[model samples]
Target: MEFRILGPVQVYDECTGVLIVPSGAKQRALLGALVVKAGQVVPAERLVDELWGQCPPTNAANALQAHVARLRRLLPCGEPGSGRPHHEWLVTRPLGYALRLGDADTDAGRFRRLAAHGRELARDDPGAAAGVLRQALALWQGPALQGSGQGTICAAEAALLEENRLVALETLYDASLLAGHCHEVTGELEELVVAHPLRERFYELLMTALHRCGRQAEALGTYDRARRRLAHDLGIEPGPALRSRMESVLRRQDPAGAAEGAARAVAGPATGTGPVDEARTADDAVAGAVSVRMLGEELARLRGHVDRLTREHRELAGRLDRLTSSPVAGPRDLAS
Candidate 1:
């Protein structure tokens, strides 16, 4: 049996071509809660709280039990004498219930595993990584846990799953760029930039793709748009990576001159040179010194960016801890 919760909550039996889906919204929510926290006993109180949320019925426990019974009957019962009973899939514990998946496959689990594998492949085999990541993304039929009741657990899990999907998308773009598919991904990256204006990484990738395709002017224009958006929305400037990419576009037109200048600056005074040569060497040394100072400033900015990212990461981790520890009130559009 393959339990699917990536989209609608349903259980499929490949052997018999049977699809068992809980018809009730609450039942789907109940099954979703169990599936997300599968292999562990979710306390009865938590389940009740998620179902009714501050307005639970007087006999909430019994009502919950009734719902569980209906869900169990709706699930598949394995084989007649296979020794694997349907009840084994949803077992009642002293405090609550557990979904013992046993050998059953889940699209969520497979998507995560495949995403990890694709990330690993991204370093050395980006083409292969793109393929694997596409496969992982193809598992999503719609919004995660769609049609499930608007419970805290399901809502939070759906949001987290959707965030994971976005991360996988960013990884896919990275792999696509590395595999020399810049032109192909440029359109999607542009759309992503518009959809997620705050995501500076998308802007960076789009700029890079445009620059690689000899659209230097457009690339610079994209950087300007990103800069203006960041400034207007976040009251901040672009980070080091985006700024560096923009600088690359600015210097794209005179690559030979830039390379030769850098070489001359690094080489210092030429040996046995004339007075004019010595003067030019001195100029080159001054340019080198200026370049070194500019690089130091850029490094300082990068360090600040790193520090900001670290603080943001810590804040997000703390928020996640709180979300997992307690129930969040309100419904979020996970599909968005």
Candidate 2:
């Protein structure tokens, strides 16, 4: 059985190709809450809060139990001949309930895994990175948990999934550009910049794509628009990366090195071009070298940040595992 929570909550039976979806808004919300934090015990009170907000009915616990039981009947059991009950997937604990699942059992989990693989491969092989990221992106059906109602937990999960999807798209575009597909991505980058005008990185990328496609004037125009938007909306200038891209565009310097080589081939030697052209070429070369050095330094800094974040994530996961491994008192336990 595979669970899909990238959009609505759905369970697919591998053996029979049947979809088992929980009925009602509350039941789906309940399933979403458990699946988002899969393998952890969610206290009854927490489930109740997610299902009905602060104004839960007096019989919320009984209502929750009914939903869980209904969901169990709809979920898939283990292998065909196995005596295990479908309810085994939804384990009951003294504190509350845990939705046990293996890796790659849920679309969200699968997306994370594929994205991580793509990132790891991106530094070595951009072509492979683009492929992996494309596969990761193919998993999303629509807005995450679209039918899932507006509860605090549901909203938070949806936001997180959307953010991840955007990040994956950005990564895919970066890899595509590196693989010499700048012209191919220009239209998509245009749409992305319009949708996310405040995102300096997207503007920087769009500018690079335009410049590479020999649309230098349009690239400069894009930078001007982004600069104005940043100032008007955030009251701040663009960051170093975006500013460097703008300068590179104005100087006719290639951020990715291809255009520079092409220019050299077309212009022959520095001596053949007139004095003014030679001087301009010399200045562009110096600026390009400096920009490349700055970009290298910035990349190193970002890599360090990625490493630190990876460590922090691992530590947090370890702490969460420890917390969930041991049972804790719930609201009912406190009441008794």
Candidate 3:
């Protein structure tokens, strides 16, 4: 049986799938409240505020009674079996209700315990860390209640659980990297960074993994992206750790620091020569092709022009020759 808080307060019984939350906002709120304080007491007044916030409806205690009655029907397996006809996981308290989880079970609780163990194993035996974290992660079939907990108080609880989930993921990634499984961390890290642009740790892990994989340029680019995102979204640079990591990367010092640095210098100004080289190679394949086309057109025009000019020059030369070769003819011509 699983009582989820990350989305909505859900009851998942292995034998009975999902249990329905009784109708009415107060009733639903009771289930959520019970899940939050699972295995602990939730005072009636606290349930009132959690359900109605600052302005609870009249007869709030009575309303709480209705919720409990409904939830009681859905008692999880292993709940305390009293000698009396009624079994009580939620016993009548002097002030409020107590959800007895020993009588119940929750995936959330199991997941958290597993995550704790995984974190403990992260620095020592990463394989064991991966195994534990994976088990913890596997407990989440989907977002709690498929995003059912969007209410004011419910959302808060959901967000808290989600944060823990991400933390577990971070530890998981660390373990994977230590186990020399850097390649496997990319997909998860990419999603995490996108989902949480302000989280510098995710960026750090991403940068480091990229560096370790010999993708130094990509690593630095990732850092630049983090800087830009933080500046754009939060009007601040990446926190100290990320900024420090970036500096080390640019200087090619301590490339293997706490966070990975690709150890590559920042990209320099490009001269557009990559395209130029490609164009030059392609044009060389058809050497002088363009010049030949132009020359062909110019040659036709020049040849015709030159022939006409040459014909006129020959005519003038013939007249000059007559005067020089025939002396008398030349004198008579001059007289005429």
Candidate number with greatest TM-score: 2
2 or 3, which is superior by TM-score? 2
Candidate 1 wrong stretches, greater than 4 Å: 79-87, 254-336
Over 1-336, each residue of candidate 3 has an lDDT whose tens digit, in order, gives 556654445676655465654455556677776776777777888877777777778898987787788778766534346322333567778988987765456777888899999998888899899999999998876565344334454566667778888899888888888898888888778898898888899998888787677665577778879877876888665677986665444444222331221111123214544543444443443334433553464466558768989999998888778777884675567564
Best by lDDT: 1
CA displacement after TM-score superposition, residue 225 of candidate 3 (Å):
1.0
Query: Which prediction has more favorable lDDT, 1 or 2?
Result: 1
Please say which candidate is ahead in TM-score: 1 or 2.
2
lDDT of each: 0.83, 0.81, 0.69
TM-score list, all predictions: 0.72, 0.74, 0.66
Off by over 4 Å in 2: 78-87, 102-104, 253-336
Q: What is the lDDT of residue 185 in candidate 2?
A: 94
Give the alpha carbon lDDT tens digit for every residue of 206-231 in model 2.
98889888776688778779877986
Model 3: number of backbone collisions: 1
Backbone clashes for every candidate come to: 0, 0, 1
Candidate 1 lDDT for residue 151: 83
Model 1 agreement with the true structure over 1-336: per-residue lDDT tens digits: 888888999888776687888888889899999999999999999999878889999999999999999988877666587555544688999999999988788899999999999999999999999999999999998899999878888999999999999899999999999999999999999999999999988999899888787676688789879877886899788898998887766545433334555566567646666544555555455445544664676577668988999999999888667666766533452221
